[model samples]
Target: MPIFRPYDTPRDGAPVLAAGGVSRRRLPLNFSEEDLPLFEDALEAAIPQTRLLELEDVGVSPEGMLFKDWRILPESFSSPSIMEQFLDRRRSVLKFLAANYLLRRRRKFGRDCLWIVDDWSAGYFHWLADALSRLYVARDAAKDLVLLLPHRYRQLEFVQSSLKAFAVGSVEYAGAGEVYFCRKLFMPSHVAPSGNYNEEVVRGLREMLVGFYGREGAGSGAGERVYLSRGRAPKRKVSNEGELLDTLREFDFRVVHFEDHPFEEQVRIAAGARVLVSNHGAGLTNILFMNPGGRVLELRRRDERERNWFFNLASATGLEYFYQLCDPENPDEGPHTANLIVDPQLFRENIRLMLAG
Candidate 1:
């Protein structure tokens, strides 16, 4: 039996591609002065430097767990702390042991390969902001390497369209329940922490995707006003969405259900939006495609203050960030997944202020 290390051995000489810096969140227009202390840390945070390293004889599990020399790599998990907790739980030790030792059936890639797939790669927001951001950072290095992804992602339209947009040359997928052994793995450090973002890398991603999908003179007007609807989702819906939709219509906001459209259409819609309104959800991730100086008004649950993913995104992409806290229809359902009950009057006031600026 072998023990797992939270991270790989420090590669002090790893190539640093992008330098880290401070990222500041622009407070919402109607932000309360009394709550400033609640968001002080997230208001300004340090971004980590991006690095590219080469690892030999690395083994990757189906969930994108990376291990070499009996030590797990931090890149396999969302963060090192999460890896520590995973080890604490001891739930996957037998599987890990089997994959590294007794698992005789393994797929071998005998070339310089790039591994950007992670546990969260299936989600749209993480796919764009996390996985693709790594690919963008390793664009030059990946030219000659085979990009490895999970087989399940092969059929996702956004995944295919985005890879095509990036013009990634070589790609191969590792099957489920199979351990992959790469002779030489070219791994790029995450562009930034989970919620924190790196301005340069994010802006670079936006420019690349927008260039691929943006049409001439499209989204160039005062810009399209958009309201993203989460009506199809099982939870976290706007309980008073009908009244809000009426208000949104008054402002000429186009109601968009992102799932109804294709990936390219979503990109175009995002590129054209000068103003975007949505409850806190993955749909807001499209802000990455909007032009700089655009505005976003997020409807948040009053108790859910710490999840600042969209706020950090807006800051990174130069979008005006605004928010209105609403009460939860089912407070017992918890903050992240609770349905929101918004006051139409407050929403109107916030919209007016957002548009005026």
Candidate 2:
């Protein structure tokens, strides 16, 4: 049965593990009355129920696609809205058909398994904020539940450490170019809409992670400022980072690259930050670990005002949020991937204002 509108479909037989409701977020400090309409939908969005779906004889792909009897299950993709937003319809259809029809090798598992992998599970930001957050809802079953993951994901250190922290029973990997058939599959609905957050669930997950990995007295002290650098990134490079770094240094800011550190180390570094400064990117996702009331300064592209993932997160986590709009080096490259140019003088002004309050 192909579910085209999984969001509207009633949970006739599925059990509601975590109830859903509406949540409100405070607007970013820089937001004005004119920008209210732009964020109207997000300011108070409805969170979806975290329900458990029990399916028999379901075929699972390495990319987290699920199907039964050669038919796709839209709910397995998280939500129909996310599918339409991030995936190419024609390409997805072709891939699904090829996986079920052309692929011959299939591995069958008779034991019930829990599947949480999704299309965006590979990326660091989505892995933590979206994929792993689902565990919070399914935590009640974490004791003996076997998590199914892609073959390559089994080698990622962060993934391994996170699973350990969650106390998941065991893990199974789905091989590339082959579909695994599960006799019984246990899947959970998304805890929140993609890029949106549920404060209680998200904060709870963050606390659990910190409690497990956090070191005592790590990155401690007031007036401890940190700058997350995107210097190694292919796109979204800060053209004038050297100049910006010089100014940041005057204020005792320590610049670091999150990619260089282990998952636990990243948590420790973020734990003591009184202020965090970084361009709008995945590195900012670490704000979830920071102490509440800490300030966040996001160097956002002027045209990319609607991408408020970090803003909403700061609010949900009880952090004060602020943003400084920077110009893209090449506007033709587009807001999402274009390099940015930060004005050091403007940054100084913003920093002073942030510290004053």
lDDT of 2 at 86: 36
Query: What lDDT score belongs to each candidate, Candidate 1 first?
Result: 0.83, 0.79
**Cα lDDT of model 2 by residue, 1-357, tens digit:** 233322232357888877788878887766657656546666877887788877788887776777765556765564566666534465667666675667657888887788776777777788889888887778778667778887789788888777878767788888876778899878777778777887888889889888888743664474368899999998887988999877887888889898899888888778768789999888898998887898999998876746788888898899998877888998888876899999889899888878888
lDDT of 1 by residue, 190-245 (tens): 88888778899989988998888884247356338999999899888898899887
The predictions' CA RMSDs to the true structure, in order, are 1.8, 2.7
Question: Over all chains combined, what TM-score does candidate 1 have?
Answer: 0.95
The deviation in Å at residue 272 for candidate 2 is: 1.9
Off by over 4 Å in 2: 1-10, 30-41, 76-95
lDDT of 1 at 24: 77
Ten-residue segment with the worst summed lDDT in candidate 2?
1-10
> Which numbered prediction scores highest in lDDT against the true structure?
1
Tell me the TM-score of model 2. 0.91
